[model samples]
Target: MGPLYCALISQIAIILAFAIIGAGLKYIDDAFDEDRFSKKKAISIAPIIVLIWICLSLFDSVSATILFSILFAVLLTGKIDNLIFKVSTIALISILFLTQMLNLLWIPLVFLTLMGVADEKGNDYVDNHATLKLVEFLFSYRFCMKMGLLSLCILTLLPWLYLLAFLAHDGAYESVRMLGKISVAHQRKKKHTIAISPTVNE
Candidate 1:
């Protein structure tokens, strides 16, 4: 009935939406060949991701939160194995990078580069490369979001942790939960990728 309640509900819905899509992604990747998702499966999941994006659009003004969520959805669509979706995601990121945040261009650039490494597994050099850079950047971004949320929480405090105050804290970083998370492919193939990636004579 109130703003805090509304925020709490919206954030919960957002988390559930991401989690559901993430789980669906697991199945999609596992049950089929790489880059192959059925139209039925895609049909079921697309609306959920789209709905979350819409909700996030209305809920938060934080650029990182919105961008990351859309990025995640784009990643999921790629798993759908549709070239169109992949191209659309690329176009979306390019538009964002070139047009929206000049200062933040490096963020998406690095993000896309790191993502490319997963596909570059066969190449000895790329596979041998450590994920320290990507992980480090992710941790840095996570830290920034944490600080942003903390400051928002402190500034918007309402009489010792009322509903509004708690919601305010949660509200600041919409993408907070996704920070430092493993993509579906990385989670599924980490073992093989890591072990064979370093070998020169494979």
Candidate 2:
């Protein structure tokens, strides 16, 4: 293939990898949250996921790398409570420091991280308290980050393609979450059936 074609393929590969890794991270979190797996298992797998995510971010351009690193750090620190996640995030932050990835784009980082935090908090609130359909729908899918990224793109602060990649990551994360919910429901149904089957037979 020509160099252009090769470069296109490489970009596609990176986006796909991000999607898969994002899904894996969500799966582990969902497993723990839904009681499908032990906290120990989630903790054990978190470091590997964090490491891979950091390594992949390095492959992007410097601007994208800094954005990804800052956003990732913000989300991890602001939302996650697990000890392993906190430790991994600290390590990730240290990597950013050592590599000089932390730059003077603090304003944008603050804006994006605030959007991320809003999404996280809004999602939780909507899940338990929100009654309006539109409100629930927006937060349920975590649209805050999407909007923030789009704003940045419109302002020429970030490339448009990064928004698409972020969508891919969010899409994969939601898909895994939905599948996990279904699996948990199915397991509950199966156990209920099994428990009553013997009485029905008797």
| Residue lDDT tens for model 1, 1-202 | 9999987786665555445544443333333444333546655655554445434434443433424533553364344355434544565556455545444334433443344333332232333655566654444333333333344346652122222322333343323233313344466587777778879556
lDDT against the true structure, each candidate: 0.43, 0.71
Clashes of 2: 0
* Model 2 poorest 10 in a row by lDDT: 61-70
Provide the TM-score for each candidate, comma-separated. Answer: 0.37, 0.83
Provide the global lDDT of candidate 2 against the true structure.
Answer: 0.71
Over 4 Å off, model 2 = 37-44, 61-78, 103-107
Instruction: Summarize candidate 2's per-residue lDDT along 95-134 as a digit string, tens digits.
Output: 7778776443666666777787787778778878947999
Clashing pairs in 1: none
lDDT of 1: 0.43
